[model samples]
Target: MLFLDDSKAAHLFFNRLMESLPDHVYFKDREGRFLCVNRAHALYLGLRSPSEAVGRTDYDFFEPAQAKQKDADEREILRSGVGFIEKEERANSIKGVERWVMTTKLPLFGDDGEMIGTFGISRNISEMKQAREALNAHHRLLSTLIDILPCRIVVKDREGRIKLTNRTYRTALGLAEEDSVLGRKLSELSSDGRTQRYAEDDRAVLEQGASILNREDYDASPLGDKRWLLLSKVPLRDASGRVEGVVGMAADITAQKESEARAVEAQRALEEKNRQIESELQIARELQTELMASSMQSVQAELAAGSPFLPRLAFHYEPSAHLAGDFFQFVPVSQKSFALVMCDVMGHGVKAALVTTLVRGLVANIRVDDTSPAQTLHALNERLCALLDRPPLPRFVTAVHALFDTEAGVVRMASAGHPWPLLEREGEGAAPVSELECGPALGLIRGAVYRDIEFSVARGDRLLVFTDGWTEEADDDGEEFGIQRLAEALRRCRAENPYTTLDDLATALRGHAPGRTLADDVCAVLAAF
Candidate 1:
């Protein structure tokens, strides 16, 4: 071999280095025609050697658009006389897929210092380009999902500074674009007294590297509107599984809170009403028991007196509820004459009790000196009708009045649409004594007339005065304890002692239907002469 000069040897070494590079190297003339190509460029072009790629333009293998772009790049490099780098560009290859390449081109000059050609080096960067594109698409999808979510979402860095917030969070806080809430600490953005507490809680979550789910009441808006929010915060971790930051979400629950409060208030009101009703019922029951005891005591005391001609009296009183509208009284009109009254209002409970009390007061205060039974009833109806005409008028009541003169041995009775009185003799069957068809009920029609019927009372004759409550009481199966039943019950007990007979009658009526409650007030008075 002949010895070569240093310059020639260096030129040979540079050509070998270019061919060995893991890239395509080429030189193009000013008109963009290839002048020379390295071994790598020739291999990439599907040529066995550089001689096949030399002396060809890019138009020989590239599409028109690709050729034009390459020519423009070469012209730019030639005109600039400086190296130019392109991070990524597309290159057509003999294979099915296009290749992504990073290219650097420098201007080449002749010995005259005039630009001659462009020297280019290209490296394949397809994988890196695909990865960067995928990353960008993922970021765009994540941002869209956060913006459209219903709940407020926020992201904070490890330092407790806000990094990102969703659309819902910004809208709820009424923040403007000029307000840079990002990179700000929660305590700095929240001006309320509770902000410091929230910051402390966030610190705890970070230190513990755990999640926090809590229900909190906050007044965050400038208008100070209270709202309930369910907050959930989770720690975010880095690739090393170390806690990096926290992501939080808050959902508003103001409407649900208000509804629960209303429900609680309604329950309290219902409980209070029930308590009032129960208390009233208790008081009414006690009053009714006391009234019955007083009436019995008066009858017993009158019996103890030395009045041989006095009529023996007995009573049975029961109520459907704690209070009743049925009442009965015996007044000693004189030593020889006595008056008896029974009254029943239209309804029961507090309303009926009020009318029954009014009737009781009227009968106690009214003077009926030698007055006939019909006249006394007429007077009572007029008084009751007048009372009903005032504000808060009463409904109506059925009443019966009777007067007996032991000296004359005569009994007179009248009714205001009340059930007729029953009369029983020692050897005769019980019969209704007063007329069945009578005047309207008391307080129904003012100045209404009443009819009186009189009969002689023989020795050992019994007169029974009662309100319709006794006949109207219902059994478990809804059958009434009717007038016929009461008459039969009396006939069975007629021969018994008057006091014992009354007690037995009351017990029999209550026991008529076992396990069944009484459904009305009952009052029965028995007078024996």
Candidate 2:
């Protein structure tokens, strides 16, 4: 360093240095009166020259309160031989403009080593203070934003130490106080060691720089309540694209998993119940078949021993479902006279099968020899109406009852909303007995009547009485095998044996049906006189 040799030159250098400085610099006596001030300090006090502020105190320019506080601070510094270094305080210009200043004050000493006064410097820091406050406010807002999210969020460093966690994650950890888990590893927070598994995942993200998304895991709460969690972890990287840590999020899906489990259990239970119902239906179908077959055998034995004019009686019965709605009854009016009742109840399956059972019981009670064919149908209708009248939907049956008097050589027939039978004469081809007056179906009216039509039958003549399932058989074009078609089919199957004729007729009707399948229950009775 070079030294100034002349005193005047040293004095000039000092004054120039003070004038060029932007900060306020001043020297105050022990009584807190200004002895000399730099140009910036004089200008701040509203003085045109530094000489004007030589003997003035802070009270001359500043408010009394501010000046008093400054005097007290300087006195303390002087008495303790200490100094204030970059202490922040409020400063007001002579024009009453408020500013923030960073100040340093020291106790000054003379060349003789005795305490002389205090010299201090101050710099404005108002803009820097405002910027710092704004940054702090933004940080608080961001913290509050993440805290309100429902998803549990956590951030960990490469060392597996927790760096940040939101409110939801803290609650999962059983932490009531905020940010207490920071700087601690997850394994340290719990003794169950389940957190160690989570640490393994975090390590993968930090080491391999790969993300794990939507990983479902079973978790237990601190109180040991079982739950399922869906976790997602992403590697947090630095500016250089190197993995630095991990950011993990989790969602509690316990309710959804439990609901799915319950649904699966319910579905399994329903399937088992359906199987039980199917087994019961199969049993019912077998029982119905046995009952019908037993009745047919008994009637055939009676006819084989008692009557010779009525040579052959054959029937073809089929149902579209496991259970049938069509059934027939043969009541022996006498050794030489018998009546055939063929019925088709509305619908198929279990409900219609039940109705057929009711009809069979009703027919068993009627006296076929005493009542005419029309009178028998009237009785059946009244009984059905009385039994099945009150319902959301109406149940009904279409029936055709025919009395064959082999001794008298005549057949009496009546219809109740049923198709009239086809009469195949010995010489003439087959034709529907359309002369019968058809009445309403049974169970529809309380006192409906039907008129009987009588016609003579010679030996080798055949009578075919069938339900609508035969006449209503449809082809692919929706054309029904109507009464005329059924008459034609019967004529085409005119064999000497009634059983052979019925089998051939059934084959012809099935050929007309689509896919050789019947869409409804079928019942037909053929008698050769």
Candidate 3:
């Protein structure tokens, strides 16, 4: 900066002043020939020293195209007598390496108020160029990744204009490129309802600097196709804590919504099926009840006056479920003879109750007038085997058939694999009558036969025929209320009517099996003579 104008020291000082500066410094004549150069400028041109670059024109060192451009700039500056400051230039150096330079050129004077040449200084900015290029490359990569994302992404300015859009967003609108949609208002692409909603959301994020997250939307196209979307918006902020704009993203949730709708439909179908099943069960229960009532009425009647038989007939019936396997009836053969038949099918439910009906039909077909107890049972058994063996799964029934001959004062009784009937005489104790196991249970063996035994009966003697469901009941302690307990119960009911004796038996079984539900159907036919 030492300037002693019009002195030899001034020329010498100026010559050596900028030699050590790292920037390229040189003075060139109007013809673009180098008049002087610093050591740094000589090194940049790949010269041994300033002496190598001095007096050389630009064409001698630079490419022809670059030399022509520079010659044009120098002539322009010389004609206008103006200077260029901080201009950026890009070119290959004398060493053949491309670089950028920040350059300043000014008109040089001869100290006589006349322009002599151009004074220039250039600073190599290659490192800055490399950094800026790297930043640009990263921005391009980020933009590519955003465009390829599966979710629809878009950016809107503070005025709700579409500033940017990704590939998915444009494709959703059936557009091939975002160029046609960018810088347009949202109302141009969607309905008023959608645009108003978008405007509200944009205001929240861009103006209020808020975030709208996980907002769901529903839409239907003209074809009646429905869709679901999840959207989120956040404010883009500058370093000064000011809102720059808003960034919005939306994800399609149509599949998830459809799956939920299908699940709801399946649940509704299941509920309807359950209702159908319940209705069928109720119908079955009502039909079974009607059948049982009809069975009772067919056998229920008071004997005529002046007859030898009892004046009162009583019975007890209870089913473990809606349908029962146990059934009984009274058949009046003649004025002086009658039969009480009680049967127990193997299991309880619609299947077993169906078997009981079959047993009833077979018993009604028997010729009880001329046949004995054994012969009547034999006829019922053969018919049941024929009917039951026809089904895929077989079933069986155990029964007791008792015929009272009032005129002869004797009882002819037989059994088919069933528990013995109880007889309580006026003077004797109650006991299960011993009879031979003459035949297998009905429906188990074809052509099975039964046997009868006759015993004298007094005028006031009581008879009880019942199914095994009464004797085999169990208490919480797992002990059975066996036939012995039933016999004892019958003995206690000797003073009451025949019907009261059956009730006492049921009450005794419940006492023994306290707090227990009925495990099987119970039935009894009681008569006094």
Best model number under lDDT: 2
Sort the candidates on TM-score, descending order: 2, 1, 3
* Candidate 2 weakest ten by summed lDDT: 1-10
Tell me the deviation in Å of residue 26 in model 1. 33
Which candidate comes out best when scored by TM-score? 2
lDDT of 2 by residue, 272-312 (tens): 99799889888988787677666666666666464546647
Tell me the TM-score of each prediction against the true structure. 0.53, 0.64, 0.52
Q: What lDDT does each candidate get?
A: 0.77, 0.83, 0.78
Q: Model 3 misses residue 467 by how many Å?
A: 1.8
Better-scoring candidate (lDDT), 1 or 3: 3
Tell me which of candidates 1 and 2 scores higher on lDDT.
Answer: 2
lDDT of 1 by residue, 33-146 (tens): 777888888877778988787678887766678878988888877777777886478888535347899998999776677898888889988888899889989988998998
Residue lDDT tens for model 3, 67-126 = 788888888889999989988888685569688888898887776878888879989998
User: Candidate 3, TM-score vs. the true structure?
Assistant: 0.52
Q: Which portions of model 3 miss their true places by more than 4 Å?
A: 1-224, 227-304, 309-311, 392-394, 427-429, 476-478, 492-497, 512-516
Worst 10-residue lDDT window for candidate 1 reads 1-10
Backbone N/Cα/C clashes per model? 0, 0, 1
